[model samples]
Each structure stands twice: as structure tokens, then as C-alpha cells.
Target: MVHNYVMRLNNLQRKIREEELDAYLVTAQDSIYYLTGATYDTAERPFFVVIYPDSPPDLVVPELERARMKKAQGIRVVQSYFDYPAAPGGNWYDKINALVGGISKLGVEPSIPAEISSKLWARDIVTYSLVSELRLIKTDDEIESIRQVARYADKGMALLVKNMYNGVSAVELLALSRQLQKEIVKAGDYDPLDNEFITVGRPAPQSAQPCSVPDYGDRLRRGPLSLVCTLRLAGYAAECARTVFLGPPSGSDAELFHHMETAREIAFSMIKPGTPCAEIDQATRDYFESQGLSEYILHRTGHGFGVGSHEAPWLSAGSKDVLEKNMVISIEPALYLRDTGGFRHSDTVLVTEDGYEPLTTYPATLAALTLKDRRPLKSLKGGFVRRAAGA
Candidate 1:
């Protein structure tokens, strides 16, 4: 594992050289994890990583993370600073002189707050925007952990859809979805969720507009089409979303939903190493335009996932980042109408040299209700999420 981890760091070093950068400063908490394997929130105190291409990287952190970095392997160099709220010069700025060694050009993640960047180093430290784009791809071990999380998300979403009988309160469904996510996380040997995403059937007859009503207490009913639902299982950062029908959907509903699914397929097929993200978005947009539904695309084609539910390497026209091997992304393309609800489907795809591998393996079955059919109609258990079939 450490061998692969070092190689990943080397890949970033190569990227740094190609970008004409001398070093990169990492402030995003997850970027710290990506580089150092020392998971930290970096909230209580400043945690920073200074990576110099072809040299041992330096980590600046409060004394709290000293032992943590020591154990991550290849972390031979680290600088620790202390915080004394009651004392002067208590901030980590003193270590700046020691940490910012020989870096003429610096690459920093834009996710770093402006305030943090302002104090990190000298005003003249030529800073370039450097997000951990390489982190978007999935390693075998990383994919395994996320697969567990996505499986849990799929089950949690399934539970939400299964209980979508008329008169079920949105709050009740949301509560149930949270409960299911808790169980799935627990099953994966992790604690209950600290962060998650759960949304129910939207409020639109034929259109997919933002819910004006607080979706918390609204009762879900059979609508003009299907429901846009999602459940994020733990901050392990797995996401599952789908447009499930309330009852049997009509022909028009099925046709549109399948079209949205097709858009998703086209986008997925377009992702691979070396493909520009703009072309992928254009293809999806062109397909939607061909279907005469160009105005309904509310957002980008997709976004990167892992460590956070949303991050860099966005799959949209605005992005110029090229896809690379091992990158995991969500190619979710949806059409939302103001008259009818939306049809949204997404899967977390791992970009491979050959093509792509979808880590999110939930079946896109129109007959999802059938899976719920076999289960007993007992009172809804607090946190019983049906696991994904193969998981």
C-alpha cells in the first residue's frame, strides 16, 4: 500500500514539473489525506502539506498530528507548530520560514480559504492553482472502500423508494433514509453518519422545479412522473440518486426517463483517460438538444467524487481538465422541466485506460418496485437497509 501511495505522490511530482511548478501547497483537508495518508479535519488548527517535486514533502501541522504523520510511511519530514491561544505568536505562521523551503513557484488548491492563503507564506510566493486532480481516480483499495459506501447508498435509496407509498411524510422518509444509511455504515465497520444527503420525490406535476415547500414534512404522492431521490451514505462519500416512479409510470414518463438514462450513458461512454471534459458535456448537451430538451439541463454534466461528495475535475463545458486513469467521477445528466418532475440517474464511474468501471453498481431497473415486492410489509424498521444484490 505504501509503495502505491509513493507512486501516486511521484505522479503528482511529474505533474508539478509539467505545470512548471516548483512545489505545491495542499490545504484542503482531503488533499492532505491524499498526499500524506494522515486523515485530519484541519479545522481545529491549520494542517498544511508542502510538496516539492522529487524531494521529501514537508507537513506543517499542530503538534497534535505529529505521531499520525510518522505512521503514514515515507513521511520522513514534518514540521510541527503549537497553538497557544493565550500567548502571542501562537499561530502556525512561525513555521512558515522553515516549511517554505526553496519554493519559487507554488501550486495551491483553490479550495483553501483566501484568509488561510494570505497568511501561509510571503506575499510574493508566486501561487498557482493546483487541485489534486489525480486524486479523482480510484485505486483498487480506494475503490473497494467507496464501493462499500456506494452499496450502502444504493440500499439506503432503495429503502426510501420502497417506502414511497402515498401519504408518507417527507420527514418520515428522510428520517428512514438516514436510518438506513446508519445501518449500512455500521455494517461497513464505520460509525454512524456525520454527513449525508437524502432527498425525496420533488414537488412538480410535469416540471422539475426546486421544491418551494420545505420537503421535510410534505407527504409524497403519485406525481405526473417519477421522483428524484438521493441518499449519501456516510462521509465515506458515496452518493446514489434516481428518478423512481410512484406507481406505474406512463409511456411518456418512461420515454423521458429512458432518454435521461441515455444521456447518462452517452456521458459515461465519453469518459476515459485523455478525453477533455468539455467534449463530454457537449455530447450530452447535443443529445439533449436533439431531443428538443436543451433548456432543462440545470447543472453541469457531472462532478468528481471521493473524500468529498463534490470536488474538482468537473464534467462540464467550463472544465478544461482532461480525464486520467483511476479517476472516479459521476456522469449525471438530467433534464428538469418546470411542468413535470425530473429524471435523474447517476453512477460513480472509475476512469480506466481501457474505458471505465462504474463503482456504483445499482441496477437501473424500471422494475425497482419488484425488488421491494418480495420484502414483508412489516412496520418500517428504524435502520434496515437492503444491501445491494452482489454486495
Candidate 2:
């Protein structure tokens, strides 16, 4: 009752009916959960959601998940089969075909199991890859769930800031973030980590940015100015980094951090409904130019975040999608020097009828707590992060 899987079916049905499709094969884990409330992750034994727009959503799961699928209340029909480990003679494709036959138009997530999809294609059928566009704007429930995740993120960021000072390594801070309270993130029954996700950096040198395992080293120190972007909690990735001064930002460090924060402010200020994503990007770049820090603008403004950390409706140099209500995003226009480090302001934002809602409220603003006092790293609640309303 809490999660109306029927709503997803309703929307998908409208699309399918318009195109006169019989069924849509959904292989993506998120898509399955969004449509059936039945989630499982066993790549060896494939599971899929075969949604018949006209009828109820059916699930094709393995024998092991049969009882669980049968007990599931949302999905009305479910078909179980023996999978890869011992499904030699069993033809699961045939079952899939039976459900998909006559469905002239089939919709699938962009990232599907290539092998399975290739064999499942029909000559007379229209297979649509509705990803970025389909997920462009989130529903009210989706928005609320993400907002809940942001609450934990905001709390986590606050904890991180409280411990900010000399001698704290990036690795330590990263570890500390993992140790903060994850109450709000897990509150809505959405498990983001166990779900398909990603967390990486956009380091000064792009190569070091996306490394799954980075030798955080002494990359964070009391010098230059560094920004620490971390994916701290579930269902959300806090892609914000700061301009830390080696021993309290001063001179060039202070100057750079100030300009970078302004750049981010410029971008955040431009976040309104109907604004072009690319134009928002240009606004940030222009701020950097105004400060004569163009060369330090390392990455494309920012990107979309949801079930996957990096998604569509990206805020890049040439994106064309207009910002819309309930579309959550993070705008981190930054400037970083090679060994010196960087400065960035990133908040998980929800686009509103007016401006945007900042999910995390660490308040890394230049004037807020640039060179604040630092006590020893204290034990934070929930071991991961805290709640953030807005800042």
C-alpha cells in the first residue's frame, strides 16, 4: 500500500498503449523494483519483470525466489523457472517470448543485459530505450525518498565539517563518513548501497578522479586548497568538495576558495524551472572567467544523481534539457590547482516551482566556516551522517 507499484505500471501502460505494445521486458534492478516491489540481485540466475500494460505486472524469477515472489502482494502474477546454474535444457527465453509476443512495441531500460536482449528482439516489434528521458523528472514519492536520503547526507556533511582541520587525511574523513548515522537513508526502506551504485572523485587530474580505490594519501593537508567530494550515504551521492587551506585558508588559498564558492553560487542561483542545463553550466564557467580562474575549471559543471550516482539530464557544456520541478541535481562548479587542491560547493538539490532545494546543509560557504575552530574528531551519531533540511 505504501509503495504503489501500480503507478509505475499505469505510466508505462499509457506509453505502451499509445504505441500499441503488448509487453515490456524490464531487466534493470531499479526498474523491476519501481514496477513490482520485488527486488533480487543474483546475476548468475536472471530475474525479470515482464509488464503487460493491459494486464498485471508479471515476474519471471528463479526457483529459489519462488516462495518470496508468490508471497509478494503487489505483483498479481509470477512465473518461476530454474536458472543458469542448473537450467541447461530449460528455455527461459521461450517463457519471455510467450509474454512478449504480440507486444508490437517493447520498452526497455537503456542498460539491459545485452546477451538476453539481443536474442529477445523481434523483427516487427519496436524496442524503445527510454532512460534519460523517462527518468528526467521524478515523481512525488521519488522526490520525498531522495529528500530523506539528503537528510542523512546533510547530517554526514555536518559531521565531516566538525572534524575538519589540520592532520585529518582524506582517507580518514572518508572512513569517518562511513561511520556516521545512516538512519534517515534507511528510514524509507530504500537500501541505496546494497542497490546498484557508484562513488568516485573528479580529482584535479581526471585520471585519479574515478578510481574505485584511491590512495587518498596526504592529498588532504594544510596547504593550497583542496575539495573533498565523497559519496557518503545511500540512495544519494554527496558530490561536494571544499577548498581547505593548509593552515586556515589565507592569501591565495583564501582568494581561490572565495572565487570557487562564488562560482558555485552563480550556478545554484541560476537553477530555476525552464532554465537550460547547458546555460546553467555556462553561468558557472562564466563566473570562473569573471574571476580569471578559467583554467582551473576542471570538469563539466555537474551531472544528474538518482538510483545511479551518475545519470542523465546532465549539467554539462551542451546538455539541452530544461530544468523542471521535482528534478533533483547537484551543481558543483569548481576550480582546482594541481598539487594545491580545489574548492567546490555541491548540494543535492530539488528543483522547485521557484528555485531549488539544497539537500545537504554542511554550509561549506566561504564566509560560513572557512577557518573555523577544530576540536578532536568526535564520535558522531548513526556512524554515517545526519539530517539536512536546507541551508
Candidate 3:
């Protein structure tokens, strides 16, 4: 892990030099974790890590978190403040400027606090991120971590299916599945960094918007339920989602489900190195339209996934990124019918030298997802089991 952080920091420093940046400043916690192997809940506190071409990387954290942040690798200097609104010597901005000495220009990330940004010495400050594109290509160690968490996500989905039943509310289902997934995460020595959204109802009308945890009151009777789960371990993330039916699916539901699955297959076939990222998205959408489901497409086919839930090399209709080996992306081909629910299963994939490799191993077949309520069993005096009243 220490070696990985050092190598990534070096790569980012090289990019800073290429962009002619005097120094690069970062505030995003995930980006910091990517470069320093430190994970924490920043929670309104101002935390910063700055990198330079010649000087060692420096970190400024809250005094309360100083001991924990100190354990991270690749950071040459650590400065701490007692809290926010500290005096002159206690401010992170002041310490950062002192470390830079006389650098003329500074590159800052998107989430830099206004309090600190206004006080920087650089007159020609630019916006740049050291971890965005660099995170697209996963190292061997990163791939392993992603795969491990991906497996945990798969288990959570299977548990959801086993527990799904008629008249189950969205909140009830999500709570149960979360409990199950949490056990697996702890057993694997991992932690939950974000919420898992499970929507069990008719397709949402707003398809272009972000997916959120469904309202607890909406009951899922006998139709389709969409489940999306993301798991993270050691600062790496893996996500998988699927739409399952409570009972046997209707003919229309079956058709659209298979169509979306077919679109995912098409996207997978076009994931070889050198293929245009937009081309794969266009191909998937083309296939969906060919099957007469064009109106249901809410957004792009998928987005990149790694330390963060979404990242670069987006598979959309207008993307300019070219597919490169080792780039990790999600292949999600989904559509939302006005009356019916959404249909989709986002799979994390890795572009390879020749083709792509699937990191998510969950089964998305109709049979696998068509869940029925479990029947109770009764035992007789001879210890023989028989179907209960409901069965």
C-alpha cells in the first residue's frame, strides 16, 4: 500500500510538471486517499494536501485528526491546526504558503474551501486534479482490491433476492440488505463509505437524475425492483446493480429486460483498446433503439468507477476519450418505461490489451432474479418435514 501511494504521488507530480503547475493543491478526501493511503470523514473541516515538483508533499489536517492522518504514507510533512477559525499560525492556508516559499502559480482542486482559496499567494491559480485520470488505470494491487469488494457486492445482491417477497416496502428491503452486506464487509475487513440505494416500485419518471434511496412507504407488490449496491475496501470501490421481479415477469417486462441485457453485451464487445469511448456508447444505444426502446434511455451507457463511484472515460454519446488498456469502467445499459420499472445491471469492467474483463460476477439472468416468497416447512413426530399451511 505504501509503495502504491508513493508511485501514484510520483505520477501526479510528473503530470503537474507537464502542465507547468508550480504546485498542486487537493481537498477532496477520496483524491487524498488515492495519493496518501489515508481515509477519513472530513465533515466540514478544512483539510488540504499540496504537492510540488521539487519539494516533498505536505498535508495540513485538523489537530484532532493529526494522529490518524499521520499514519498515512507518502506525505513528507504534516501540519495540524487546533480547529477551524484558528489564529495566524494555526491556519492551514498560512502553513501551505510558507511551505511553497515563493512559487508563483498554484493548481487547486474543485473542492478547495473559499476561506483557504482567497488567501493563497498564487495570482494565476488554475483548476487541476491529480487523481482523476490517474485513477482510471488501476494497478495490479488496485484491481485485486476492487475485485474483492465486487464479490461482496454480489453477495449482497443475492441476499436481497433471497429475502425479497411480495408487499415489501423499499425501506424494509434496503434495511435488511444493508444489514446483510455490512456483515460481509466487516468479515472481509472492509467498511461502507456510502449508502446503497434499492428502489422497489414502478420506473421513476425522472430517468436523467441520480438514483437515490427510495421512499420507505412505497410497497413492492408483484412487479420489478431495482437494486444498486456499492462496496468499498481500503479506499477502492466496486459497484453492481440489477432489476429483479418479485414474481414471474410480465411479457413486456421480460422483453425489455432481455433487451437491456443485450445492450450490455454489445457494449462489452466494443471495449477493446483503441476503441472510441463514444463509439461503444453509440453502439449500445443503437442496439437499444434497434429493439425499439430509444425513449427509455435516461443517460449515457455508463461511467468509470474506481476509488470514486464515477470517474473519467465516460461511455456516453459525445465523449472524446479513447479506450485504453487498464482503464476501469462500468457498462450499464438501462431504460425506463413510463408504466413499467427501470431495467439495468451496471457491471464494473476493465479494458484489457485485446478486450475487456468483467470485474463484477453477479448473475443477471431472468431465472436468477425472478424471486418468489419462501414457503414454510413443518416437521412431524418422526422428524419428517411437510409443507406448511401457506405452502
* Model 1 poorest 10 in a row by lDDT: 382-391
lDDT of all the models against the reference?
0.65, 0.62, 0.73
Ranking by lDDT: 3, 1, 2
Report the Cα RMSD per candidate.
Answer: 5.6, 5.8, 5.4
Q: Which one is best on TM-score? A: 3
lDDT of 2 by residue, 1-391 (tens): 1455677677776776776666767787656655665656666777777766677777888877888766443576788767664544455676677777555667766677777777674545455654345566787766766665566565555556666555444454555544444443454554443332222222233322323344444333355434444453333344444444434555776787678667777788888899889998888888788778898776878777665566766898878778888787887777766655556666778889999888766667555555554534432321222212110
Which regions of candidate 1 are displaced past 4 Å? Answer: 1-4, 13-22, 63-73, 77-80, 84-87, 101-103, 128-131, 177-214, 224-236, 250-255, 272-274, 365-391
Model 3, position 146: C-alpha lDDT score: 75
**Residue 283 C-alpha lDDT in model 1:** 94
The residue pairs found clashing in candidate 3 are: 203-341
Q: Write the per-residue lDDT of candidate 1 for residues 13-39, one digit (tens) a residue.
A: 788888877677777776666665565
Estimate candidate 3's alpha-carbon lDDT, on a 0 to 1 scale. Answer: 0.73
- At residue 265, candidate 2 shows an lDDT of 76
Q: Go through the candidates in order and give the clash count of each.
A: 11, 17, 1
